[model samples]
Structure formats: structure tokens, C-alpha cells
Target: MKNSTPKANFESFSFSEDILSAIKAMGFKKPTDIQLKTIPAVLEGKDVLARADTGSGKTAAFVLPLLDNLSNQNVYLRRGRDERFDSSKRAVSN
Candidate 1:
């Protein structure tokens, strides 16, 4: 299998401190391929459809940018927050 590490590290991107801290806490030292590919699109408010085998950090690939987007704006709350996104566990269930 090809290596998945991206050329950029977590801090290389202009992520807020909260996201950076969370990534660090999660022991994520580098961006996986999916993360590298999807994070920018997600942050740019572009719709993304991604597929990868299991254990590919798919959850974080979306969740980190989602959290950043949500934190950067309250649009979701104005539209009536979806309970699914209220918690990570709940998000996966839906």
C-alpha cells in the first residue's frame, strides 16, 4: 500500500487553536490522504463525497472541518441545529 501521509502537518494549515489542540490530543501528527484531500474542500463550504477503507480517519476528515465551520459561524443553529451533530457518537448513528 502507498503511504498516506500528506506533505503538510496539522499546523501547516490555518486551523484555529481548538482544532489544532483537538488534533494533537487525538495523536494526529500528520494529515492522512483523505484529510489532506477533504479538509480544504469542507472548509471552503464545498460539498464533498469521499470513500475509503476502514480506519482511514474519515470521521476526523469531516468532523474537524465541520466543527471549525460551525464555530466560525452559527448558520447551522439559525437553520435549527441537527441533533445528530450535537455529539460525535450521535453523528455516526445518523
Candidate 2:
């Protein structure tokens, strides 16, 4: 992971806006133990392997960070059908 730091206890870090929004929508007020440990590591793009008892909030740990990064990208959709078709053809040919 770039800019890796010492692993932090789950209670120490804060989540970004989109994550907090989704977490609230899912009715989670605080981070679970796995969430605490995994979120920071994933945010740093580090390779992680975690094992936990079933029904833990493992899905949110990864989903939140991925959504956050994708939302921040400077991507613009194609403006016309021709542009979209051209792009798709290029992708398929490549």
C-alpha cells in the first residue's frame, strides 16, 4: 500500500461522506471490529486477507472505499451515440 502506516485500532479513524451516508442508510452507527481494522488498509490500496465469523460487516469495509475513489474520478460520459459506439468498438477491437 502507498503511504502505509501502523495499523490502527478500529475506533480511531473516521470515514468519508459517502461511506458515512451508506452506513447510516444501513443503520450502522459505529464501525464493527473488522470494519475498524480493514477500512484504513483498504483505503491505502494495500493487499489484505481477513477472516472473520459469518455475518460481520465485511462487505461494507471494501465497498465504501471503492465507491469513494470512483466517485472522485474526473470521468465524463460520452456525449453522443456515435462517440459511445466508437469507444465500444475500440474497446472490443483492442
Candidate 3:
């Protein structure tokens, strides 16, 4: 049997429009190898421990999927003077 392959492009990650727009605006043509490997698990709320050299897109690897997860929820108010994002553990200013 063949081993499972990771998703190739950022589009395959099924990110929300805002995230996708931000990615494009940032000129990220695609995910890095590490991102392709771990984003799915991260989005699934599974733990991940990765080590990569500096500037391996590691921050984006975790941040993008985490942001996507957060966006999937109605965690923030539509309009508020003090906007916040509520999570299971804590809430943060928007």
C-alpha cells in the first residue's frame, strides 16, 4: 500500500475567505513542506511538535490553521466597541 500524501496547495486547506485573502495579499503562493504536513492535524485540534530552521514558514504553518479554526466559530461579536474573541480556554481582544 502507498503512504498517505499531504495536501499540496493552500487552497486545499479550505481556509475561510478572509484567511485566503490575507494569504494572497501576503504573496504566499503555497504552503511549505512543514505546513503541508501539520496544518490538517492542527485544524483538527490535534497537537503538533515541529522543528524547522528559521524562516521555514513555521509561524504561518500554525497561525493560519489556528486562525481558520477560530474563524469557523462565532467567537467574536459582529459589531462592538470592545471586540473580543471567545475560546474554550480564554477570550482575547479582536
Best by lDDT: 3
Off by over 4 Å in 1: 1-7, 74-94
Candidate 2's C-alpha runs over 4 A off are 1-14, 76-94
In model 1, the worst 10-residue window by lDDT is 85-94
Q: Roughly what TM-score does model 2 have, to 2 decimal places? A: 0.63
Residue pairs in clash, model 3: none
Kindly list the per-residue Cα lDDT of model 3 for residues 1-94, writing each as its tens digit: 1224777778888998888999999999988887887788888788888888898899999999998888778674434666554643345555
Compose the digit string of candidate 1's lDDT tens values, residues 3-92.
334548878667878789988998998988888888877777788899987999889889998887665553422223533343212232
* Candidate 3 Cα RMSD after full superposition onto the native fold (Å): 5.7
What number of backbone clashes does candidate 3 have, counting pairs of residues 3 or more apart or in separate chains? Answer: 0
Worst 10 residues of 2 by lDDT: 85-94
**Candidate 1 C-alpha error for residue 30, in Å:** 0.3
* Best of the candidates, TM-score: 3
**Candidate 3 minimal-lDDT segment of 10 residues:** 83-92
